[model samples]
Target: MVLSFLALSACSRDFLDITPDGRTTLEEIFQDEKRTEAYLNRVYGSMPSYFWKYGFFDFLAPFSDEAYAYSGAALGWAAGMLTPTINPLHTPQERGKGVYHWGTFWAGIRDANVFLANVETANIPSPTNRERFRGEARLLRAFYFWELIKEYGPMPIVTEPFANDYDYTTLTRPTFEECVNFIASECDIVIGNSNLPMRITTEAERGRFTRAVAYAIKSQALLYNASPLWNPGNDKGRWTRAAEAAKQGVDALTAQGYALVGDYSNYFLSKTDISSAPGDRETIYEVHEPQIDPVFSIINSIPSKPGMFKVGATPTQELVDSYEMQATGEPVILGYQDEEHTQPIYNPASGYDPANPYVGRDPRFYATVWYNGAAYDNIGGEIHLMETYVGGADQLLVAPLGWAFTRTGYYLRKFIDPKLQSGQPEDTRWKKYRLAELYLNLAEAENEANGPTGLAYSAINTVRSRVHMPDLPQNLTQEQFRQRVRNERRVELAFEEQRFWDVRRWKILDQTDKLVTGMEITKEADHSFSYKRFVTEYRALWADKNLLMPIPLTDASIIPDFDLHQNPGY
Candidate 1:
């Protein structure tokens, strides 16, 4: 067999970093239980990192209209992604903008296959231990497959490691249904294994794959399978299936005492530990970073005046407008009488004040966005107002047209720890899947299966109640309810890498990605603020072809018959 191995690094203290003097044999690895376990730990490291500072901070928000890339080089990927210029070979990876894990994930899949194929031979004393290890490998493999399908659509499923003489030319992409089935089957195998615990008990194995993780992945995959992109016939049966799967996952987690933790604003901040405390109950699965400072993520989003780089992704006015009025739970409807945006009209019922645009909005708006005159308590214990208006501090006009600053008169407040100091270590646990997302998934699936049922309302209301938002209207048509679910998901899951995929799956990308707008704030002579909503001139060109990312040109070139397998319009 042509076996490949990842060189284990000593950077992480949780996993063992075993270095062989030379090329190590499978016999040497499998004969020792610790070595076999180390191999699995390496696969765990491949889980995606949302905090890594590269191409627009690897945030999916900028690709959508949720935010805009202010930094020059970072803008390259965002700009390319929004236009037809984005080709397979010149993706975010080539531009040094974001972490494209298409290749990296495939390698992890190969490692998982190798471990599963040879794990039984390892010197594991207990049969239970062997089963748990095997189950963990299956879960990791399913996760990698889920990541692949989400990015590149249908993929060739390789369960066993290929032989040295295996032919690469014979490979062909599976049907989308087959890919989904393969992932579902892997999830079933992990869930059915009795040896796998519902949750990891040991602190040392805090982030290991568990039964809850398996169920969460299954729920997500099934939900995607029922989306418009995968279900072309608008199959009601697919929606029913998705609802059942999501409900099953949510019920299992809740039965295990999982629930929302803390307020909405504090849920994503750094936690002291991952123990099963009230504060940590919301996280289903997370990419845990231990005892390390999230400086890269924090510094990228912090204002330049706060003793750090100010260039980062800024929220757009379109996203700002999505936040509903706190008093009336209805979106503020704003209209411009002229192109200059000097004259503004607001929906009388929306209760939006042009003179004071940021007041009486959804509490999440204050928690997630840093707008003009928003106060922040600095690490040095000084409260400062974020002056994003023209000629004021953090101004867009002062910087040259391309310089890094707030282009939309707003900065991200979520996931940024106010207590962070220079050179101080801050640990952040990036929740990959949470209980709240499952609830949203269930609400969407139920509405599609059985339009605007009590089940759907209850599911969505659970999320709204967490932030103390009022419940959705009691009665509405199915279509109106659908819009409510979508808008709710957008507001609740903003900047957590959900909006980008949600828009695509919902098949509303063209409508949502049309034009990103910015709030042009000006300070009046009386120290009052004047807000003008103008198009940021950054428009995303979305077509049916953009539903699926193109297979990388490098991968296609090496294939014997690329034309048959390449995604349409690539």
Candidate 2:
């Protein structure tokens, strides 16, 4: 098999760097212990970065109702610009954009396969290292497959490295069931055969895949297969399998000392360099970026100062409305009276006063959104409240539009430090899989499989209790419980790239993606802010056809027979 690899960067740590020349043959590299480890690290680097600086620091958030991407940076899907020929996320790297695509996925898988095929040739002394390295490669290969299955539905499963003369035209896509099963089986192999530890105890191996991560992959894959988009029949068997997988995952993670941290807000900001950090134990797998990067603080956050980049992403009022009231555990906005969502049908018992909209809601709301008059930080050792009202310090930009401001009348607070200065580094880690998600996954799967069971309630409550939010009512029907579980998942997992796929998998994108609303704050002469809801943008182009991403036309043309059928409505 012929294999190609990128020349490893010299700035990378000793174990990850290879020679500058890309001509280093695989056979020659795998013969040395350090080179073999470097090859494995290269495979690890192929994992998707949902919060990279490349995609304007917001990958999937802007596509969903959670947030709005400013300046068309990551709003192609929302603007109806996504096509087989043109996808912002799948654009070529030469354009300095592409986040995930066929080329990256396939190349990553090929590298993993090459590493697996040649790892034994290396002169590594430790048996534990050899076992862990093999397990990591297997899990990463499955991860790439899982990503492909999510974006483009079914895909051809290539286990081994392809030959130079391999017939690309002969390849055919597998069934969705087969695709899901393949990912689950690969993760299973890593769990059962490999000696990979359940959790990584050392800070040095923070991002490495563990047995908890494998379980997370398996649980998530099964849950997606059981979702409405894939399992249209509401297959009880599929949900049962998914529930079981998620339960196993949760149990394994808990046994390995994984649990939710006490402080919800600070957990996200905990530094990964310390093994004893508050949230470190809960993170199963995470994507690491430069902690000091401006993308986290300046780009995707409120404009605290001048000459900063235009606000990249701003939280939507729809996301703000999803956070339940703490007093009654009721949704603030029951439903909208019109398509524009200006008239919210408020629940009388929830105590959600439109005049003072930011009071007495879920504690998570304060952590996730920076609304009008919210205390931002102690700038210059004095408390500075965010002024998003009309003509306020952080007011919404209207004319002369390129100013750094919020289009949605709200700034992102999740994963952003309020105190991070312009030159300061923020501890922003894009958590891919965490213990909380495992519980949510189990809750959703259990509720679907067996209506509103104790297991489902327990799983969901675990996440809610972490944020000190009230438990969901026990008398709810299966559908009601499902909604609560979804809401819990939404508020807890906001801005983590889950909402984009969650809406699609639940087959509710047609309802949720059409329009996103924003809070229009106007400060009165008395300095009291009056809030009005208005439509930020109309996404008429987002329809049922957008449920699945299209296989890029460029990739399809490479196959001589063109047998790789495009997704429906592409």
Candidate 3:
């Protein structure tokens, strides 16, 4: 009997011991192509669930100034994340939890390593299939490592399964550059592989790794490596390399016939179902969950009215002000006059009417944010007007009833399918990488390398043209253009979990995450609404050490030399 049990459960700290079972041994598993494919699938299944579940917070927007949490206290991770109390011992669920299989991503890495080592020996009939499987395993390994680096900054890069007798404590983290090089090389392997198709055609293989996915990963990794957080020296060579890599990924995606599809708002609504015809062409990589009713995702972000799910995440006023006026394509508020932050310096060209605050704004703002008096379609095609003003239906002043309402006088409108009804089953995919992001990435990198070149403007304009927004103004200096690109990224990728990381990578967390503000709406007898912008008592704590998450305390405790190996200020 070849006992098949070398795989470690996700939570096991006894790294080398795999539970013994009566299943077939590694040899028998590899001999059968179907079993080997199943093993690879298991590795792919370890990818983190991007949606909210498993004690994880799905919307990272709250961590930034984009939003605030109404019911985040229900989840320990979410609650800890919003406060300054977060520590190495109680990091987000991305770090390992108590013994049971909860937050350990290393098990997935080990599985990928095992697959890479043995797949070459498997007796697969088709050489192309075998090579493709190998390519996928390599890409997965890179992805797992990327996840680690994204959180802990630098960590050990294990390429092979360890033996029981091997001393695990001897393992130490490599330099940041080494880890980057390792991940980049693995991506290159997948991209250069001939057996892997550029795009998977069979419906069953839709979510599998492909050449385009590899390029996307490569572009993201290069962009991170070139960021200010990682590149302290401000190397122009690094920025140039990142720009070239992003351009290559963009060019490859274009060659594969990828383009922005549908209206910006409609693209998200149409993605409610993968089976929806004329599938999203903008998606380069996405996490597809067909059986999941993604409508549950909006339960907390929506109004807490009758027949509605619970309200949780609420949009913040700071984010609302980021949107530009549609008429002038400029920010509604240019800047504040005083430190009290109550006075606003409105842009004369913006045509912003305080009486009708939400009108004449960027189309995307309407698509993304639900403000006072906004009409929302409920479960049965009934239109409900949001009354966020005082004593109104969704006002924050109604004691316990108002507890569920938005603190900022606005709710999330993006990603909620308006067509979805109560008790209806719907599915949504989180686009891990899309053409728009690549365009933004290319624009940022090009501006950094060559300083406001035509390539930079062209890349940014491509994204703007999709929403019918005007192109960036001409004759701006490099610094001015850089700020414009940064703002563009914030508005374009709001609530998509980009701002949380982007702020950190640019080392601007102090300015962006320091204070949060919300709008208080009052209704007069005439029924018109008056607004007061107040800085909320809630504030986000930021320090130099916050740029990278501390390594989990448990992992540090087990290591022989914790002091030298641990991330600083842990």
Candidate 4:
């Protein structure tokens, strides 16, 4: 995500031989306004992968602040303490937390800033078209800055863009609150004035930010502030704004034609399911990777260890337990079993007596996770990620290996597009935000702000109803309603990488530490009891404060004046 490792010329001569009309100007790159607009489009491509790839905010969403945790080797902490899931101050994993005083994010800001500055003076024709282009740049700039804000708290505003010298490291950061205000204010301007569509109508418009995208981001920022981790609404000053922003984000998308698709899997599994794609009715905004670019490959995050499911970032057992069930439209923490004495079967309909083990169970059990020894139509038809070799040796990835930790108890299946072979070149893009999430967000935020009344309850039911989950019981306490909202989010939105962020927003990383389990495996001989006792604890790791990546020590040293004070424990 940092600018490519290759260093290119800061001058345009590298691209064009000479200027026509004897106009040797830097602005020539954006000549005639049309070029300027193209410049804006190009910035999206130029976006650094840092944030998603070990960058500052990358771990923040997945690590801890408040909500839940599963003990896997967490991201960033040295002692492995500061997981991308918990208090991260005391871990060696402190990635360039302070590195921002000068890293990928700042470099990105500099580039985005330059493009935005030049865009301002371009002679674009239609004011509306010009406005849209400018708006995109501003959003990208804001996005870069927001990335900084999420981790470092605040930073110096480099609005002029980074066209200057490497010595630019001298500037100090702004106060956390100031940085928050700047991003929020700018978001409003972009949403208010830009001609961005509520839904993208073309592939070309895929990565552009629309009014709803702006709201979704703004709400996310506000929600962070409202949470205890950031002390956002320390004395209740911003909680209203948090709720208001989340509400606005959802309302804006819906007003512009966003609707929840009837099935949960469609959002991630179907490309023809444009209902959630850019310009598609369900996405408010999304980070679109060009299908042609390797970055667009969904496999990077979905495949196992090195690739196929890198790091096994499945829902913690706690999250799996969070999923609601079929027979009962409630949280099935313990799930359905064989008459409480027979045995526990995840797929009763399959009826392979355990004598056969597959029997009655929660519908989500099979859909959201890959169970130990479960069979599915893989490349050759029936293949299981847990098959054992006939003799004594590690089982193939398709088989149960000899001493495996159960691969965290549950395997994520949501983002796995069947067409994407293990290492094939699949270029379907990764969605950063979709309308389905906005609905769930609205439900959660409203529940938090108003305690499960009117809009809050209705919003939640709309989402749950998608999979036929019944309306939550009436007269439930706020705690009970809120619990439903949380679990609903886990089941309905399992692997699009939302769990990592949700834990942060609510400041409950510790709460999430308790393993949420599901889809257990068992053996058969007497045709009576069970097989294996598996849990997603496969990825569990202790918590620490270094969870917040360390500001890059190099950046801090270079910008001696840039003493951005690293996060506490790191």
Tell me how many clashing residue pairs each candidate has.
Answer: 1, 0, 1, 90
Give the per-residue lDDT of model 1 (tens digit) for 313-404.
Answer: 67877778778788887667544464433345567887788678899998889888888888866735677788888886667543445545
**Models sorted by TM-score, best on top:** 2, 1, 3, 4
RMSD of each: 4.4, 3.8, 4.8, 7.6
TM-score of 4: 0.74
Instruction: Summing lDDT over every window of 10 consecutive residues in candidate 1, give the lowest-scoring window.
Output: 1-10
> What's the true lDDT of residue 448 in model 4?
65
lDDT score at residue 486, model 2, on the 0-100 scale: 93
Q: What alpha-carbon RMSD in Å does predicted model 1 have with respect to the real structure?
A: 4.4
Query: How much is 318 displaced in model 1, in angstroms?
Result: 1.3
Whose lDDT is higher: candidate 2's or candidate 3's? 2
Among the numbered candidates, top lDDT falls to 2
State how far residue 346 of model 1 sits from its true place (Å). Answer: 4.9
The local distance difference test score of each candidate is 0.72, 0.76, 0.70, 0.52
Candidate with more favorable, higher TM-score: 3 or 4: 3
Winner on lDDT (1 vs 3): 1
Prediction 2 global C-alpha lDDT: 0.76
lDDT of 2 by residue, 371-417 (tens): 88788674455667888888887888755467477888887776656
Model 4 misplaced regions, further than 4 Å: 1-25, 32-35, 46-102, 162-175, 232-234, 272-280, 290-316, 334-365, 372-375, 382-406, 418-425, 513-520, 527-544, 558-563
